[model samples]
Target: MKDATQTIRRATFAYSQLYARTAAREIKHPVEGVVQGEIPRWLRGSFLVNGPGQASVGPDRYRHAFDGLALLREFILSDGRAWYRHRFLQSETFQRNHRDGRIVVSEFGTAASANPCGGVLQRFISHLSLVGDFTDNALVNVTPIGDQLCALTESPFLHRVDARTLDTMGRSDLRNVASLHTIAAHPHTYDGCTYLVGTRFTPPRPKYVILRFPKSEEMNGCKSFLESARVMAEVPMSSRLYPSYIHSFAITENWLVLLEQSLIINLPRLLLSKPMGAQGFVSCMKFDPERKTRFHIVDRKTGALHSANIETEPLFVFHHVNAFEQQGSQEVVIDVCAYVDDALIRSMYVYFDGWTPKTRFAQVRRFVLRLQPGRSSVSSQLIRPMRSFCEGGLRGDMPRINELFNGRPYRYAYLLSQADDHREDDIFLSKLDLDSGRWLRWHCADWVPSEPVMVPRPGSEAEDDGVLLSPLVHASDECRRALVVVDATTFRQLAFVEFFTDCAAPATFHGCFVQAP
Candidate 1:
């Protein structure tokens, strides 16, 4: 154990600053950037992203990176100039902690602080009441519903923030619209409505609910769009006591594609565990290798679920690139960043504590699901044979494609990729050719990149005719980060703008580029 511990410490010592705690600051006005190259004349929009900003309150800190508060950043580019700003989302939890100077709500991996004046028994009772009350720190992703931008997490609470000012306007609970205990953070906005998948933990009949929130025009005297939410379909739980942890799902023209993996949440353990310091909700999750992962596809027009049993090997997935139906067949194709197991979750805690597990690389795997009207069993396949991670191929995560081709057939995918030799920490922006199996990369030495967001050029029909937007941070410098614009066709850097700020600009998870008028 001693020798194994030493290996992990040495391997991850240099990357500790990636998760370092930092102060939050908001630039009220857009500051002009020092442009390194000519900005695209036609590029006009705001690139908005969200992630954890502050990780601690007073002297107590969150145990995991996901427990931090939400921070929203934006970069607007038009003509030949760019502007930038960032602000912290003032949720109920953020305001309560700021007003009281301590954490009073439980996050995903961090328990709330015990009351200072309460006795042991009193504090124990308080903790028991908060075991099921998760925090409202919607730090994962941002989505646009009508004219409002909604910040979301795995909790039932969603906060609406002003797009221009980045201020929290109000909050809405999905449980009011449906009997949902927790919701998947990644919701699909297609046609005129937003679709979400939520889980209800009602005993003896735990189920997953597919919800749809209508557009603002269709809402009838509703203050919030979620108030007019309606159920599209329902899927029964694979296991009565445990439901799989779903971060994101995908959609096609006629079906909602969801993967039920082996990583499960123990409902009894989570609801009964004492919510205290150092004992978080993430500890209650267990991955069972004996069970097979299953796929649940629901019809979009009708509220009917496919009865065919579709199962695959036991695996783990955080995000799905895209899912679409074949042009002229009864089949659907899903591309995702998949892992062999859930060991990557342990590597996240290694920075706070000196413990590491064997991690695997996230590969872009394509699964084909064949649907037949009369077939009893559905068939699925991993197009490529399982190979060693050390092989020279596409090893990356945060896969993205052009928004125009999101639910249809496409040819290109953008992602943050590891080096060819498969070094875990080394990363660069890469463009993948789905048909030719060719890979193109844009690398800046000693700098790491966040997820790549592809913005199509105005009036372009080609899938790869666009630019990739990614934020770059220096690996060694704590106060350095920049946004780089790369030509998607050439996969070369067009320009980069470094922002001036007092606080460090940390890495963000997922964001979208909205074109300005």
Candidate 2:
């Protein structure tokens, strides 16, 4: 038991620096980055990243690492020169909290003060109405919706921001176009059409609504794109009373792959819980190991759901690496970083003082679902089995791949990785060769890295002929961070622009590299 505790402590020690509370700062002016090596002249565009930045307000602090306000960071590479800037989103929740010197909005795991509710009765009434205001903290991801770059969260709210200025321009609600209560932050774009899945927790039965909108090549206003959104299909949940909590979904050329996992959201507990207690969104969720994780594939055009029973062991997943349809075969392949249960979510709560909880890791697994056209059951198998990193398995999360190969057959993937039972400095940036079943990793001692965003070189025929941009947070008192650029083909660091003092970048979740036209 002592050795097990030490292993946990060693693995989490350096990675824990990412959860530290960071002060929000807006570097409105773009500052030239001191290049350590020659940056690719072809690498021109902005590498935009977003995540929870400030986790505290006044004397109060959030209980979960995900409850921080949204902060946007941009690294512009152009003409063989690089520039950097950052800013916090000016959401209504942020404004209210900063103006009043207290938390005025409830977050994913942090409950606001009782003063905001005008007493306990109003809070109860608000929860019972099921129309309680959803938070607008778009701290999860940044992607383009039509011609506009927007920041998105699990809530129905998505904020449009100026990509060049990193300033919030406007906010739009998915509820305006559909009856969606929440949505997956990860949206897939293929063949000039963007696709997303939203869960509408309505009365008779909760349904997952698949939405699609055309990707506008020209600026058509912020709201015009979402207004173009139309419902493609709707799949009813396996259970009406308890709907699975979905963080992300997958897409193929002809179908949207939805996973009904075991992590359920109890409607009764969600609505009856008080808003000013230690309980947050996590407290209302329960994971059932007995339930099987089912897969429902919906046709992209016909809105027809495959009636075959496709299921696997109960698991929890937050992101889907990618999915592709097999050519000349009726099969869809999906790759995901999955855990045995929801223990990883509980490990992410922010603990005050010198206490740290045991951490849980994930393993990359692939599932191939064979469609039986006229049968009631579909055959599925775990093509890539789960094992510890020491056993040559891909243990990682926050995955990225070449955008050009999205919803299509692809080979390579990049992620922040770590060994299962290694020391504190075992974390690294890993490249998984899907075809070869091999792993290549890049490491820098004592510097925890974020997601690797692949930027494919223009006019390149090869899939990985580009660079990878990853933000690094140093686990030292020097107050330093860096943007490390690596050659995606060789999986080696080419150059890095280090930031120190006030310009240090905070830890980030997901980002994208938008090449300049």
Candidate 3:
């Protein structure tokens, strides 16, 4: 029995090593196919997704998933068929790193000073400007600002991407914009106004600036959108040293919800310890038990944050389902896949045997926080209205919804969770009817899914009126992939456009569907 257990462990380790060694290929070819019954004929648009693509530049491969080179993929839907295209975001750093055959600039969770490029002059010249703007691998989420689509990351700069060709045009300098060290990848858009968070992290004082930009490209054509961005609120964080590791946030009709996790990013420590070496991202953070998780709620129209500030126990979250203000009440409902501590985060630095599957579940839960602004007498403790959304079953990170229902009350949400409890790489698509705690799941045998994007039907009345589009990754075979469109109402596969490539399509994170006119 002991020998059998050891054998199984060894096999698992071998499989993981093989998977890590194989980097996704960069190939694009025309894909033609009809759905089971053909799409609405009205469904024409491109789904643009971004993630880690080229893991190997020379002899070294990326140590962590976050450090991989950003690859953008496009599935252009038209006439019941889909066209495929992909391109790596060729930032100056990507170009320089490729030219030098080594990491020339640092990544969020990566190091770069120790390179053969030069002794001291090269490193000093590189640090003249922050490394983030240089290493613009927008590998997180995609959103439109003005006429152009922008790929967002933790870095403040938004990498402008050509929506049609999946090409990186350039970085948005925001006309020499001030006040930013890092920004959230996920931003909320509604009523022609987009809400995003940008952190201003200095040595002794760190602050958050809430930005509201016009979603319309009509005004300035397709130029940089940040030039028109207006700072809605500027609130200083209590942690004066480091910025909060906020990847995403939720938005209601009247509120912008920012979750401040205890995973505090200490810049001094990150630079001093060489975070990527052995400690990874975990070493950069100093989790304070006493520093309770604070919910910083800001008024959307005005920059009032102190009015609705609240607190709860420490919980790290990557995504949000939806936030809605309960009609005829003073309460706002927020849904999140909450983690107990930084265990999920600590394991993100997966390298060789460093990779371990987490059997612990991240359940979807509802949080109720009542707010009576301007009342100093009222307490800010969160209230719970329900126990569980899926009866403690749902697990995943990226949760998506139809843009039409964003910042408003909605019923359905799409998610990506573990295919099974044991394997973290393989995933399944889940459709959660928020009204009823029921979930419908669809999956393919060895195909891993990233975040699912909901493409809404034109002139549709129902909340789940559109289809769900997910970029499914073939596990053993990355050379083949498919764009799956599932019927929103039935949760069944309506159509799929399968394509093959010489190389693997890089793993995708979040994508957006620009509806065809």
Candidate 4:
């Protein structure tokens, strides 16, 4: 149990120190100019990204990947020039551990050291600190809701930041609007509403609520949050003790599809396990090989839930590629990066230890759901699956598709992959053609890639008519970081703005490009 968890902590520290070393620093000074290549004139926006930067709080290092403190970076792209700014997302945990000098609060998966005083006060302080309520670091992703840039974790709250500058504004408490304390990092933003799942833990049955937050210029990240949040649907789960771990979902023309994978989190253990000297969130649950994966298909317009539950060989899924309803049929094709077993989640604990977990790579497969109207019965099958040509590595993550074809049929998916499974240190930026069984890949010798973001060319008519912006990092210790842009249709290099700081940034998870207004 401790081996995998222990390995991850050691790996994070070693990786951060060896290559892209990071430290907590918030400065808005003019960037040190070492940029290469030209900036596309049509590219006009701020690319805001978030990820863990502080690997250790003091001499005491973080025990889990999720335990590291969140860092936010903002790159302003306009007129063929870029300005860079970075800041750490302010958290109660960071204040208590890093600044004030004590690791008193336990993180999502990593438990803190016992209080100096091992009496009733220690127990009291422990319970006072909720598991993910306020203490969870929102390092996973960033969502631009209305006028606010929201830094997100699986936790309910969204930490707000000033868009223009990477300044930590405050936290937008979702408890005021939705009862659910947990949600996936991925939210689908449509015409004016951001569609996301808000799940709550209640007695007997836990409810998953579809929250549609209406966007307005007036929604400036402070007030009337609930008034703008419309509850689209609320579906109850089968298990009361566990909650499903979902990183993302899918949307089609008329339906919003959510796949509750076999990975179930133990809520009771997350609440009580720390008291028993056990790890928090990640340690509390076990993978259920018996249970079937569920597909909760909800009507986007009518808010009717078709619990079109289906059964198939169990697999673990984190990111979704895309989903669209098939023409002239009651079928929806959903693409996801699926792992054969729970090793990927478990390997989050073991990656650093040099012990290879079997299912680290995930294969990108399409699951077609055939839904029956009245009863909502459904069946699924895998479509033309995509695999990496490098060393039998087929797993994919950090999936991205064109926003224009989000709820419609899409032809391409952009994500990170690897060629050699044995040497897992490398990364390849891959663009998959869904229409044709082919993929285009870009790899730099020692350089790894971050989540690739797509920015459509102005007045572009073709679906693939856009530019791909990804963090090209670790080209070498000397040339630590660069934001590389590539042609979407051809997957060729367009331009890149590099970062030449004393301290290089760690891996980034997710971000959104906000077009300059």
Which candidate wins on TM-score?
1
Tens-digit per-residue lDDT, 218-298, candidate 2: 324644786778888899998988999998998888888999999999877776655435356677788999988988888
* TM per candidate: 0.92, 0.91, 0.87, 0.88
lDDT tens readout by residue for model 4, 296-377: 8889877898756655666678888888888544788888888766666555541255553432457788777777766644
Cα RMSD for candidates in order: 4.9, 4.4, 5.1, 5.8
Residues 157-230, candidate 3, lDDT per residue (tens digit)? 78888776666787875324656777888887778777788787765677777887876653366355666777
Ranking of all candidate structures by their lDDT, best first: 2, 1, 4, 3
Q: Return the clash pairs for model 2, or none.
A: none
- lDDT scores of the candidates, listed in order: 0.77, 0.78, 0.69, 0.70
- Which scores greater on lDDT, model 3 or model 4? 4
Which lDDT tens digits does candidate 1 get at residues 158-235?
A: 889888788889898888778788898888878877888988888786788899888888888987676888898989
lDDT of 1 at 255: 88
TM-score (C-alpha, index-matched) for candidate 4: 0.88
Ranking the candidates on TM-score from highest down gives: 1, 2, 4, 3
If both were scored by TM-score, which would come out higher, candidate 1 or candidate 2?
Answer: 1
